[model samples]
Target: MSMINNAHPGSSLVLLNLIDRVLLRKNKLVSRTELLEVLRPELLPKLSPKKKKDDEVDEVDDSDGTAMRRFEWNLDFWLKEGLWLQDDAGMISVSSGATQRNLPERVLELIIDNAKSQTDQEILDEKNTEPFFRAMTCLLVQQSYTFMGGETVLPGKNGSAQKAVNRWLPGERSLNLSNELPTFLQYGDFLGFLEPFGSGYIVDPTRAIEPYLKVVFASESKLSLNIFIERLAEKLPLLDGGRFRRLLEPMMEELGWSPREVHQVSPSLSHALVRLESAFRLRLDQASDDNSSMQLQLPEGKHRFVSEVVYLSEVNA
Candidate 1:
């Protein structure tokens, strides 16, 4: 089953981090029973059923069966998804591909990367791409809305936005967008692609790309604006001109989304760069003689030009 179906957005990170910590502390593989024993206390409070005021009768189970069911669903999904590995003896440990360090941002990166690795065919067959598609759609919608000077609202379960996004899929597949949007938003927040705004989330991928800057730059301290964008797109294929973004472009165009002007960056990406520059993480420079400068479109219709980007290695920390 997909993460959207098996995992609750609020509880997924909590459970994942708990497992990572337990495994790290023990410095060895832990038995399934032992792992569950450790997780139950931390997980139950969040997953346990709550009494509704409208209920005519309240029958609470002493065994905490409902919580256990929710826990199992999440655990099973992680195990099958290769985030956590189980041995022949039922000994569990974090996946080797995951960063051993227990940083939240690192873990979120692992999740995002894993989701991105799934092929479209695999997603169509196994429905594992729901998380990726939902998160991408969320970011796209927010960015477009902001660019158009419209206030952002959470997509309604059966709203026109949801219907339009769902149309991105082929007739062979479909998503319950209303049902999956909350979890998608939660994941986006954790990944730093979206930030909490007035009433909902807004596109802000600066934090999201921070962890990958070194990976993208790879010892180079500076790059031409065009090269930096290329590397960033290679690292994160969901952004502007990325493989995933390209795949969605046809559908987006059908919905009246227009391409950015020549040498102009998309609003969301421009915002991210401007924020990074302001925070001293990077410096955007423009040469008087350089004709290849790119324009960063900022809020309130402001624009800044840059020909090169200097990634501050020390400041990224």
Candidate 2:
């Protein structure tokens, strides 16, 4: 198994118990409100005291009460760990494969394994590192690329990895999973897989991630854009140009980083279609030298760029 940065094994234990309680009540889906009520006594007592660190600023709403905020934070933990799924209905449920193994026994084992240092109370150190793992998974498995026994080049700064992870786990939006590149890089070195190279990191396939990818993706062929978009839309329902702007708005605000916004017009159906055509054209430019007809036609609108060539934005690409 890969080394999971689950420093809060105590919280995992609490969640396992919570899952059992919900299941015993013949409920598969538990709302945060209902779960928080039950979790107050069972799990809240185990949470470490909120450290008054000068650098750490709590973004949680003060009126939500400590217990409520903690419950939400714990839910964030489960979401990041990929143990639970929060749906559009604002309900939480066990993920499909989370219970494949004997969870009760597994939870017990985790408790036993980490029991020696459970009370050390060093903030557990990995409360937010889950994004790195999730992002790394997406980078490798979201598209198909064989590990040719060399360094794979990932673009952008270390912080960009968190953006990829946030996109990977779309529903849990309460916690900001940015500024996690350094922690991820440090952890990668400990795992003996990734190393610093230039502005990015050099990923060695044989070290760790490759073995995990080989088993997970299992496909040798690259995933086409159509399939990639479809699969991405499953997790991120708004994975289109229309809804994508709405999603990017909050992320940009939280990250304190802005991408140049060029809204030629409101992202209507016409704009979406135009964006789609541009995407395909951009892909064609990168793809193999096949002179196949793309069959792209301009939509019936004043926004049509039939006579004039429409340029694609590499920034958004």
TM-score per candidate: 0.80, 0.27
Q: Which residue pairs does candidate 2 place in steric collision?
A: none
Q: Candidate 1 lDDT, tens digit per residue, 1-317?
A: 44553235324555555567777777778887887787674345354433344321233553646656666666676676566778888888765535545354655555557757677655334555454554454355334444334445354443333443454554434445534555555666766777777666666777877777777778898899998988887767667666666666655667566667769877778888888888888889999999999998877777889999998866353
Worst lDDT window (10 residues) for model 1? Answer: 50-59
Q: List per-prediction Cα lDDT, in the order shown.
A: 0.63, 0.38
Error of 1 at 226 (Å): 1.1
Q: Show how many residue pairs clash in every candidate, following the order shown.
A: 0, 0
> Could you give candidate 2's per-residue lDDT for residues 170-284 as a string of tens digits?
5543123222333344444344334566655544322332112222223532333333333333332222232233444444445543332332222222233344444542222
Best by TM-score: 1
Error of 2 at 82 (Å): 7.7
